[model samples]
Target: MPDGPHTAPAATPPLCEEEIARFVVERFLPGVDTGDLDPEYDLLATAVIDSLGVLHIVGWLSKQYGIVLPDRELASRNFRSVRTILATAERAAAVGAQP
Candidate 1:
């Protein structure tokens, strides 16, 4: 059988806190000013992210980072705020990138 096309690995775009914040604003809280989003804002407590919203976020995170989020990891704590979400995404990406 012929081997897969021998192409070099594609470059991964940089992941930054600003990007995460922007994504949150655009995806979850559309029409909200990006500057108003606090990194420590409690999305769940404030009703910004509900049960269905969490599913949307999980789907976005999976497709965006190419990482799989286990059912157990989908806790309020992990999706508490922009900072927490970024941390979770980075960790998941790292784990997924490993052999």
Candidate 2:
């Protein structure tokens, strides 16, 4: 046997673009298929999400990812697209995991 056995690294909470897309389509754009939602779609430009919707999304993110979103992360830019939202959530979760 080897002196030290290898072990898997701690798994970070995954923030996937598909998951974000599914949430957005379900919550804000009912009847819209997730397949139609592109990664770079302009959710704000298309009126998919408003200020109140943004708050709802922020709340969902905080609860789902177990991270308190910083005030700066509440910006609409962070939720502009599926890619952006996933990136922001992943970043926030990573930061929140630190001591």
Candidate 3:
């Protein structure tokens, strides 16, 4: 893992929870209130992000990892925290890898 603001991993696999958190905070949360953007932060409740932002994240995951997430899977549980996001991404990646 390359240090200094990790985005989705390129060679290895999908981004992990910690890397997702760093990416979201460093890339997406800039100019937003940092006080409410903790690791366990409820992104929806805090209004730290919206539905469009979740779509943006989904797009990024697809582009970066070739994991396309369908609209039906886009829910608050999947995008609520870094852990959840990584889990969702991993699931998508696994599905993509299947023959």
Candidate 4:
């Protein structure tokens, strides 16, 4: 009733590596300290994320950002580090923003 258009604002800001790290630590690794997480840390190399964990992260991202990742994009490289995940999320958000 107030304007020509009414669009919902994003629930959260553009995803960043630090925030992704915090998400990973809090949601996936409950006991892990935030300080222990590095933006460039190799989650897979360190056994931080196993096969099942990858699925969990994928599900979380889909729900959190309304993203739909393709099977080709679900490679280990994309989920290797928080930095990479942040980049992937940003890309997905950009794509989702288009009309």
Candidate 5:
């Protein structure tokens, strides 16, 4: 008991990969089992998410990250897999954080 401020280090926000995976599993999947949706799995080919789901995911991402994703950037190449989504989110976050 010899501390003045007793301040703790600030915690960093989750990385892109972590954010994307957590959002998908927790928000998108809801009650469904997430065992089948591997991080590296092909979201489109495997039908893990459909068109409407994509929109939902995009909206969720925008809302959660405070980044608006245009439709042109909402292609399969950007949101096809977890890795891609992570990359996209990272880029968006970087840009959004810029003054």
Candidate 6:
């Protein structure tokens, strides 16, 4: 991934957790219904996101949100569940938007 700040088109919609869940469910965690996804479930513990999944998600996030998730924030806790992922994503975007 690029080490510099990221940017997107002005009309691109902001990041949404639903999109994230959709991507994960459709790509990595099929057979799992997003409607029943627990916000606090430990995704890594259940193998929902393996190493490859991590790279995929991080890449997708960077492209979609135009944010660089700092190396320190790549830990399991931040990506633990639906809620945490959304929170971490929002934080990254917010920080990246700063001047």
**TM-score for each predicted model, relative to the true structure:** 0.77, 0.80, 0.71, 0.76, 0.67, 0.77
Measured over all alpha carbons after superposition, the RMSD of each candidate to the real structure, in angstroms, is 4.2, 6.4, 7.6, 4.4, 5.1, 7.6
Task: Name the weakest run of 10 consecutive residues (lDDT summed) in model 2.
Answer: 9-18
Q: Which scores better on TM-score, 2 or 6?
A: 2
- Please write out the lDDT profile of model 2 over residues 1-99, one tens digit for every residue: 879988996775467888789889999889989999999998887888888888888888877766677888888998888888888887787888899
* lDDT for each residue of candidate 6 in 1-99, tens digit (9 for 90 to 100): 999889874785656777777777888777988777767778889998877777778888888767789997787778877778888888887888889
How many Å off is the CA of 98 in candidate 6?
Answer: 1.1
Model 2 — TM-score against the truth?
Answer: 0.80
Q: Please give the lDDT score for candidate 6.
A: 0.79
lDDT-superior candidate, 1 or 6: 1
Cα deviation of 83 in candidate 1 (Å)?
Answer: 0.5
The Cα error of candidate 1 at residue 36, in Å, is 2.1
lDDT of 4 by residue, 1-99 (tens): 776788897676445666678889987789988878878999999998987887888888887767777787788888998988877767776777889
lDDT tens string, model 3, 15-47? 776657666776678765444456677877777
Model 5 gets an lDDT of 0.73
- Give the Å error, residue 26, model 4: 1.7
Error of 5 at 3 (Å): 30
Candidate No. with top TM-score:
2
How many residue pairs clash in all the candidates, one count each?
0, 0, 0, 0, 0, 0
How do all the candidates rank in terms of TM-score, highest first?
Answer: 2, 6, 1, 4, 3, 5
